[model samples]
Target chain A: MRIEHELHARRRSRNVGLGLVLLAFVALIFALTVVKVRQGDLMEAYDHQPRVSLTPLDTPAGAPAEETPAGVPAEEAP
Target chain B: MTDINAYDASPEGEFRDYVALLKPRVMSLVVFTAFVGLWVAPGQVHPFIGFCAVLFIALGGGASGALNMWYDRDIDAVMNRTRSRPIPSGRVQESEALGLGIVLGTISVMMLGLVANWFAAGFLAFTIFFYAVVYTVWLKRSTPQNIVIGGAAGAFPPMIGWACATGGIGIESILMFMLIFVWTPPHFWALALFMKEDYHRAGVPMLTVTHGRRSTRRHILAYAVALAPFAIGLGLTSIGGPLYMAVSVVLNVAFLRGCWQIFRRSEDQAIADDYAVEKRVFRLSLYYLFLHFLALLVQSWLGGW
Candidate 1:
């Protein structure tokens, strides 16, 4: 059906490989950003870690897990 | 190979020839070793930074390949093993390879510095220079010890990777470097023994070409013997545990036995089986590096598990 198979196979593969590498780099940045956003944008997260949470875990009635940030209101910290 | 200028007949270069310039197969090994180095280090690198560092390291490795192709194109045309490569086959222009090498080398190093520590980027820069200039341009045509010294270029990856994460080197990384360094001669020499004519044809002065086959065989055994302590030594380091130690012991014993088989064989014997022992050992050398690294990964993973 196509003589171009013999013609440009090598070129296509090389372009695809480079394209894939570049795409991966871009995708990683986007993914990491999403992870950071999902993790509540802890800018210092790398010093710790930021990860995506899939299902929200249920909290016990009227109890909060997180300690309030220094001088923050309870509702905002929650 | 047709003419050294085959690409001229084809006009604009095909994409694959550009890939050939990067030498992807070699890049695979470099990237993996560097990944292991980065992984086994003490602290965590941001996943994004880690990914960028490894990608740039791979690009740096590819850049070295381009420069090597640019410099060695003439000899590559003569060697049967290399005659079909892009530069030698005229599928890629010499200037293109050189340009790609310089651009990629510069970008990779600079980006690495921006993303990781300067120490890792600096190490990567030195590695590209060592491979492209020190090993390929200077030593390869000059002496039998070419790969021996040139092997250091390949050996630097893990250290660079460790530095990428830890911003420093340690005994563990040094041992990883030594494992590859000690193993290189025998690996290349075994390939040289079988591809003896290729080196001879290309005037590349590989150990087999400089020394006779007997000497080459002796060198392979000697290197394999020397490699035992280093290989076993690595298993005793922070990276090693019972599982790694066991794998190391088994691998070293099998490797030594393989070398002994090659050592005992005569030229007549090698010819009888088409250098089966040499070929077997060559293939084993690939697995040998791989399994050693795999063992480290296993140790790290299972220990954490």
Candidate 2:
């Protein structure tokens, strides 16, 4: 029968704590990457192609409204 | 074959010892002020990014704290207040503390740059260097004005948080920075007045030890008076509102009154009263800062409504 020494218990706890910290770090980095990628998509999507869903059908000029789903406001008529 | 048990024979620092090296109490204050600064800034930050920014800032603060513990271990060993610290108590090695500080500091700075702006990253790097090299290694032992100058290290977090949101500095952030910077001297001097013996024993040239308690009291009152304009000035900034103004007025009046009382009391009276007033002022200083920041946060929330 093997008896676990008190020192071993302390060491185990230390190892577990360090492991948890590292795991958390990895999770945070992954989450950050996803959020950054999603934001990039939002920024580039509007410029790449016309999004018909974003256009306001009620407007006669076939233009997006002053405050449309795309978040771009209509410019004042010159 | 090598003995696996050999490593266990020698003493090892527990996980909590490593955590203790980070100075969690100071980190909490850093986190709070940085959060408040980020909240009150003009632009909106993504929730995740804001969370990461504050975390990185806290890590930077913690890293500086570790470096401070490593450098000041000698003085810490001698001071009764610090005798039980991780390094002084033999729970953590000096080299380990230094290594942790450098690694954490680097990671925090880099991550902040990637998630926020380079300006905030640079500010965090400067804050770490200022605290670790300028304050801990240089000014702390060399001059009685150590706390006065070193206070800048603690005052930068709110500005950094503001930068994280706006990607640039602003007058509002400057005002917040000044409020903390001016308030630091009196806050620390009050503690120094009551804990003079600790500094005396540790050989640290605190204002109380080098300038005498009388001079230190005078300095506290002087700084307290100087602190009023900055504290009140923050209320007029873009972030301030009626709530903030009222809170600042009351807190400043109470703070000035406390300082005046400390300034008037003789050493004999302080001793007879067991430094009751000095201790009370020190506690009040904590509330004074917390409430000021809290009022700003509430005003920001109210503005949102």
Candidate 3:
């Protein structure tokens, strides 16, 4: 009876350890999925090229925009 | 003192015991400093990524705590403060804690890499290894200088936070790291001074046990002297402002005075008062770290405004 009880205790402890391991593994997979979904197209593009340029911003009229030579709006003239 | 009852007969270790194994108090400090790091950095990260970074950092810290508890189970069983810990109390088996620690540690690092930047993930991995392998398994049993060198492990969260935001390390990150590193010795040794008997019983070789209390006191004073300059020096960096400088000055002055008082007292007085001075110093040390990081957060907010 003593030996049988000891074996059962050992088995129970092993199962508990296994459960904790499984929980941690599940959490890791969930985290990885979240990162993947969030990255979207950015990950794909970054993999292909190392550098990307930013698109220029459009300035509204009479909004203290960057001054062109002759004090004329470059976008307006051309 | 020798026969004090530290562990009580609780129910067989359950999920809660496992959570307790992670040392949540320590994890909180890790989270706060890492947040400060993320907040003060000079760029913006998506809110989601920032949150993920902090989460993974906290997990990594917890993982380290779990591993420490696992490895130190033998000594922990003997120490009064640690006797009630999961492993010592037979609530959770040692191997279970070890496995939990390893799995969580790996997951946290990998998630940090995928969610934030590789730099942050790599730093987290190194911090875990440093604490688990270098400190827990090696330095802890070997020398009294364990906490001094091991302090690096706790100091990495802020740098990890900085990396999450900037995707690289900078002077500001190093300063944050140095602040914690310098603060650790004095903070921990204060507790060690009070808990010398516990450490002696456990054969842990703390500074007070290996060297005399007088030496430990002197060491605390020395570290406090060094810490003040580093604390105040943060004010001159890009992250610093008048508010942080003022707070740092006052805290450092108060801390230095405390250390001086600790140094002036003899072992007899410490024993007579049940090491009240040492205990007060330990509590103050906790407040010191929180206030320092809080001051940094305030400075960052004020700077933005």
Candidate 4:
């Protein structure tokens, strides 16, 4: 009877450990998916805004200007 | 009542404790600055990439914080400010913190590269290395100038933010970097002025412990004087305008006056006031950086600079 009881306890402990590992893996996957969805929304928003390029040195004094540098390629401009 | 499994010294891992391991205060600053950087970039970035950039930057920042905690677990146990940290408080294992830090650091850098330009991603990777290895591992215990040099680690986010938008570095981004670099010493020294005992207890070799409070006070004044010009100079840049200039003038004058008061204070007076002036200045210094960045954003929006 004693031998049988010890075997049952070992089996239960292993099963609990396996359950915790699976739980942690699932949580990590869920967090990553949420981050991905948020990124998708932001990308869509960026596409909707008007794009301009202006350097800090190029703005005239006292005037509110977008200050895009002349002659810089648009595709490469940030 | 059946004995409930309530207060095990080692309860199966709690979620809140894991979050605490990230050093949320530092992470918040990292996120804020990185956002400002993204916002202030010259052209529009796809909002998705921008979000990814900020997320990765923040994770990188958290990774450094985690690693710092892991490596400093010994000193953390000794300091009052850090005594309750996850690792030091026995809430999380040191190895767990290390593993989390390394895994997060790798993921943040790789994801940043995949989603953003390689330049921005590269900068993120370097920043993690600078904070974790150069500042935390090498400098913290070695010299009085630790904060001076380590300040570079904190200053990189704005530059990285700039890179994310433009795919290149520029004079304005460099100026933004300089502004924080100059501000760090005075802001930190003011805290060191009051917390000298903590440094002494931790044997961390802070300026207060090595050079004495008077010298630290002088250094604070010097750095504050230097910072004024840099802060105001940003006004002359394409990013600057009347709003930024006005904010810069008022804040710089107040900061100078605060530093002057700290310098002129006698030890007896400081003790009598319980270092009230130093404590207040320290609080103001926190506002000082945040306001500068906010002013920049406001100027960019209102003045369209």
Best by lDDT: 2
Please give, for residues A1-78, the per-residue lDDT of candidate 1 as tens digits.
634543366667667877986897688668766755665643442322222332235657677555445566556655
lDDT of 1 by residue, B1-305 (tens): 56535543663466667877899998999989998888888887777678778888999999999999999989988877789988878777889999999999999999788678799999999999999999998898998899899999889888899999999889999999999999999998888777656776667777666678889889999999999998889878877888888888998898999999988999999999999999999999999999999888888877732
Q: Model 2: residues >4 Å from true position, as ranges?
A: A41-78, B1-9
**Runs of candidate 1 exceeding 4 Å displacement:** A1-78, B1-8
The candidate 2 chain B region of ten consecutive residues with least summed lDDT is B3-12
Poorest lDDT segment (10 consecutive residues) of candidate 4 chain A: A41-50
Summing lDDT over every window of 10 consecutive residues in candidate 2 chain A, give the lowest-scoring window.
A69-78
lDDT of 2 by residue, B1-305 (tens): 98777776465778999999999999999999999999999988999999999999999999999999999999999988899999988878789999999999999999999889999999999999999999999998889999999999999999999999999899989989988998899999898777765776677788877778899999999999999998888888889888999999999999999999999999999999999999999999999999999999999989732
Taking the true A–B contacts (Cα pairs closer than 8 Å), what share appears in each candidate? Answer: 0.33, 0.62, 0.00, 0.00
Model 3 lDDT at residue B169: 94
Q: Which candidate order results from sorting by DockQ in descending order?
A: 2, 1, 3, 4
Model 3 agreement with the true structure over A1-78: per-residue lDDT tens digits? 433444345457657876987797588568656766775524433332222221123556556644344545445544
Q: Which candidate achieves the best DockQ against the true structure?
A: 2
What's the distance in Å from true for residue B140, model 2? 0.1
- Chain B alone vs. reference chain B, TM-score for every model: 0.95, 0.96, 0.93, 0.95
lDDT of each: 0.84, 0.90, 0.85, 0.82
lDDT tens digits, residue span B266-304, model 3 = 999989999998888888888888888899999988992
DockQ (0 to 1) for model 2: 0.35
